[model samples]
Target chain A: MDWHQLWTIISLPDNIPIVGMIFIIPFFTWFGLRQGFANDRLLEKLEGDPKLARAHHRKTQPFQKGWARELPVWPYLLRMEFLAVVIVTFILMVWSITLDAPLEEPANPSLTMNPSKAPWYFLGLQEMLVYFDPWIAGVVMPTLIIIGLIVIPYIDENPLGNGYYTYKQRKFAIWTFIFGFIILWCSMIVIGTLIRGPGWMWFWPGMTWDHNRLIFEINRDLHEIIGITSQPWIGIFGGLVVGGFVTVAGYACHRLIVATEFTRRILGRMSLLQYAILQALLIIMLALPVKILARLLFRIKYVWVTPWFNV
Target chain B: MEASKKAAAKSAPLATNGSNGSRQLLGVTVDPQEIKQKALMDLNAIKQPTKTEVYKSIFRVKHDQTARSRTLGVLSNVFLHLHPARVNRDAVRFSFTWGMGGISFYLFWVLTWTGVLLMFYYHPTKVQAFRDILYLEHDVPFGKLLRNMHRWAAHAMVLTVQLHMFRVFLTGSYKKPRQFNWSVGVILLVLTLLLSFTGYLLPDDQLGFWAVTVGTNMARATPMLGHEGPFGPQFGMTPFNDVRFALLGGSIVDANALLRAYIWHCIAIPGFAATFMIVHFWRVRKDGGISGPNRIMLESEIKPLRR
Candidate 1:
């Protein structure tokens, strides 16, 4: 086929070509002479020559001497992950069996139900929206959280903690990470679960993440006294730039405060533990907003099969 | 002379055979005639410059490179191709720890695939919603697994996307060139959560109904969304007119909500996400792999020629 006809490979779905791969692979293999591989000296040496095989295998053996190479976090994480997956599956199965929620009405296009809530998971965002304007809940906070997440590997791209304690050396970052996670999450959940009612509230009853939306509004009004651009996009972009600048500058300053080698070691140790806790807190926090929103908006409540098992 | 030539020929094919075993790019096709033409054209393009070399020769042969050379680049030489490389291997670890982003992407893949299968069974309406889910779960082969994988993967994507952010924040990856991407990631993350929200509203069960109710209620609460009376405008639209209409598709949440969420979750949000994600990963590689003070690959070591 000509180039125009050939470009169809690009337009075909991801799998269609992959399916072609299953056949095209062997087609090319035989066409290129699959029977020829046997003629290959390397292949003959690998399979037929004992001495060459032995030499090659021996040369590639791992160096046991390096304390570093023995480290194995990937496997460890994989095992732990498997356990988590199994446990979660078992729990879901049990819940599905026991809860046996009524199928309820058939999906009627015209029907409306009260205490209409979102899926329990989304209660967090739906709940957050209660406090902040749609621009904030639907836009700002969720945006910040995910954008913040995607940057993790970039920030700590250091292969330092590849084995176990990834940030074992960065005590300052550990605390900073944990602190941010906890503060952000706990505040969201607390605000979402407690203040929620007909809508969001800023006081104890049922306000959302921006419980103080009007307060922030007042502050913005005050800032306008000087000359702060209050446009949402401008505010968001400006806030990010300012926050990022301050954080980097702050990290540099803090690095100087705990400058000793021993202190540095101590800091690293603390950072790792804090980092782990922060990881947990993040999971909890992520679950919270959606969960609360789901419950509040959809009336779809969650029953942790074993209340304690719930994150 | 004949015996020596045969022996050398046998050895030559060995290396060539090994080289041929490498994985081809996804869209490459190598027909025999095409290969012959391409190889010859490539040979001419790279041939040592002859005595006729002049200003005219500069544009003549070089501009007309064979498709093969363009596909393969100048890396075909053993020395160059072996060392030819890119993307530090360590960069792969920068993903959200539990494979959330990838999982999300994969879920999208699964959803699209299964969604097609589901389309065979599902029609976008209150009538078809529950039956399709039930049929898929009970009737279709591995339908339950497919549905379960889609549902679980969606949830997992949400979790993973969040964790990914947490990782980025702690590591400070969002500082600069990545900031816009981070912003895009955030948009994608919200879209992911939105996808989950919308998808949940599809099955047309109590779970689906109540979920949309609370979702819309929350939507209405935001001054930008929910308002009331004559002046209640959503995101600046006439009250109950614009955003909610777009969200629910009509005046209230019924079949409209289910249908809207399904379309957006299945089509719109994911399409938007995939578009941005391509940009996200490209921007990432542009920014360079994750950097830190003590990366393993960064340490002074035998830099094995490229991978």
Candidate 2:
């Protein structure tokens, strides 16, 4: 193992946030879900006993008979805000003092940075370029992501978990978000930052980024593999394959949506339009990982190719 | 000390006698001892600064431990008034909310101040930009620290903003009345990313230059607008007149791109983000404060679909 290579990547000042995210995301996930599970257990107890449910405050937080249910924001909430600011300031100060921000040589159009990457946050999009065309990965995907996030509240039909954390109550919503954010987005960024090296080649952690290395592999379009070599016919066959994949994925999503009685009820609340939008977004989201696996395992590049675009 | 003691002794009886010890000066009757006592009372009020007129004028509320005073303490101040007079007691707990939103705002404030300071030493021209950064690192006092803090806080802001969105999603805080605010928040998230991206190009170093080069290169594939995008050529788009050209102000990352990035980073985007933030916070209160550590509802409570 090239420990020095691994250390060099890890110790790069710009990568600190990703390293921090590796720990922070998991810690906060556990922290949040722990509370969620605790609330679920309490919910079970309260649901079984009607009398206690009536008397109970219904929150996991401790409450006494004489205590006020609300507190003034002045000393109570403001103090917490002040403390958070002070703590953040301290962290930033220490970080700034210890590590210097990166500055390479002056810009020269003649010389290109090998494996030139975008900012760490945009690294996810950069990595997406490997699997799809720039139009899809760069333009369309970002626009869709923002639109999908904006429409989340309007589309989510579940009402049980509103204003509180509960895995049992919000199983579908929580799992979908975890898959999108932690698994897909964050993991891509980490991969782009640490694993992808010179020439955008994949190097396992602790492996040297050998600039001279080359891999001899041939990637083929789905139609090419199927031995079709004509314009309209090739386009028709690829479109059929894409359509089939979508139909199958849509059915799977439908099954998952109606998996439990609670989920079925939630699904019932959604309008037909809402249901369609949700399915469309979910299928597109699922396509990312499916495409990544196709390229990695099977050397498949494009499933669908047309005069205008390839997918 | 002797003069004050003699004056106190002389005024002692007269102060107690009230109007009887008053003497005429000009057309109005005036008492020196009474004036002395009034001045002493004013001095005492000054000692308790909160009771003074200047303090009261600014605060417009008492600082006592009473509920009314406490409520007014937050409601009266322009900065603190963004918060409600009171909040759900459980909402104050760190575990409930995680305080990421507030930390994100604080980091923005830090970035703004540090950014302004760095701007004083920076130049957006092709030749001067790199030298200015070099000068900042080696010559300017604490300039390295200033630039470092700005960069790190920016990274921190992006992380905290994501975590804030994650927490909001995890708690299902975007339901019902909060749907619109959540949309506003998504816009703010985009603005935050754009702000950071624009700032990346200001140093004119290879790292930023190439990062930006790779970034703006994506615009070259924006279907209808970019030259290399599908059908873009059919629509008469080219390297000189495409969306990428508009973004970079030229065919390549050059002096014009640096200036454009500087303007967007320092002026335009911050303005938009701040305006959106105002709406976000306002809607948060209108939507009934922070989505809470509330009682979990049961499955049986699910209402039937309308229509």
Candidate 3:
């Protein structure tokens, strides 16, 4: 099809006038103006007014504020968001299960093969990561970007529109922002393409990674990276079973201990009494396993960042 | 006044006294030849709020200000489909703002729904991802709406974020007190966009495939894409072999890229974004509660714009 055909295919709905939508969509959208007249309180409350009473009093309820109103089951979260995801996941699962093609075998490394990309979402980053050094692309950049994000509210102290900015007013912010966008993230997309090839994307032996880099059991390089010796005991049983458990347990314990110290003696009055108990139990539950596993198998050197989930 | 009402009835039967029907005001009746002079008097009543009444209205526990809250108030009076109130009624108002770690739980909620639904039929492999999308559009139940909402919400999240940025900038909210958080918001925005763009490519159609190809090629223009690019001769690397291979999850858009995109879209980036959003909101609450600059436009000013 021609470009014109593509344009026809993507045209906005008829109700949205072409020229008007450009200016209208943002303003009307931000104001939520089209939420309809009945959705406004002044209009609804006017139902008692002699002029527009019949037209008001909200035939339907207007949403309320403060801590007093009843809320949807998920609170701030929307029902549709979950619904849309669940329905789609199941549908995709069914479609894939029934399809004729085979899921390629347990991923092979020796096969100097075709198409070795990460998940497509990361492909954009992996595609970008190709340009930079490995440490920068894979480790330093992603971590810093994420950590940097944790400080947003502390940085943008503007208490105004809650969510609106003009280009000029936001120049420094907009300019510095481009680094994360066009540079770092785009590099991540490049990484998958540039970094992968046969073995760990490196010529070294312990470039150890399972298909999709699953690292079901941590290996020598991973151990050395964590400043620990590569013991067969740790590799077989300790790392595989005990290490995972104890690490998670230790973190749980730390969180619990912290919580307990902070809790007041008068718990019965606080609604959080149950929550505090639950958190304490979780700590014990995790800590016990760490103790038991360390005694049973090889010792865990330290609580290092795991290959999966980055922590 | 009753006399004027009778006289106006001779022409416009619905005219009421002291309404727009009066031919004379303050005894300055204009002549028939110069009736136009009379038509020009300020043709409206000032909707002036009494100071006493306005103050009473302000404290009237019922009429709390804020556009979103007011909208909900109206919705509550009539249609009762949504859940009942929960005391913290204003939670959903800033539902659009993703605060610190860069996004709200709501956006994650949106991502999860759209991501999972897309995953149901999506193949992480190049050949099938596009077909799956086609199946979703043409075959699945309510699939189009799901896809459309997913796409639109992603777009809305982007736009809202930009607006959120503007709100910060205009208010000078991203200053010393909010600088780091501002930077974080910027990163989150980038991540959000990256998430949206890669998902766009997952379908594996010409649009999806070529867009990635072209987009990456533009990046390769930055002294990469290897040796085959326009500047590849200068850089001394094979063009297609240089930068392009890293993109397609193999040599082309294939299983690897799809799977990678799926994993990141469903998990990693979102995981990171969520962690940050929590911190962002928490800090906002601790720092001084969410910023509430007097940002509402006056109705009278709005009326002129409307006309």
In terms of TM-score, which candidate is strongest?
Answer: 2
Give the per-residue lDDT digits (tens) of candidate 2, residues B1-307: 9999987766553223345777654435687778999999999997888878888788898878999999988888899999999999999999988998998889899999999999999999998999999999999999999999999999999999999999999899999879999999999999999999999999999999999999999999999899988788988999999999999999999999999999999999999999999999999999999888887787766677676
The 10-residue segment of model 2 chain B with minimum total lDDT is: B10-19
Estimate the lDDT of model 3. Answer: 0.44
fnat, candidate 2? Answer: 0.88
Overall lDDT per candidate, in order of appearance: 0.48, 0.93, 0.44
2 or 3, greater by lDDT:
2
Write the residue-wise lDDT of candidate 1 on B1-307 in tens digits: 9999987765542222224453233334334566779888767756744423553344232323454443233233332232212322323342223344444554566556756676677777878788877887688986665565555555545655665665554444564445666777777776777777777777788757766765564444333444531224523555356556667877677777777777887778878888988887767657653432112111122232221
Given candidate 3, what's the lDDT at residue B75?
44
**lDDT at residue A65 of model 1 (Cα atoms):** 41
What share of the reference contacts survives in each candidate?
0.16, 0.88, 0.13
> Which TM-score value belongs to model 3?
0.38
DockQ order of candidates, top first: 2, 1, 3
- Candidate 1, residues A130-237, lDDT tens digits: the string is 433454465445555564555453443232222112333344445545544544443444334333433243344322234235432221221233344545544554
Task: Report how far off residue B109 is in candidate 3 (Å).
Answer: 1.6
Give chain B TM-scores in order. Answer: 0.62, 0.88, 0.56
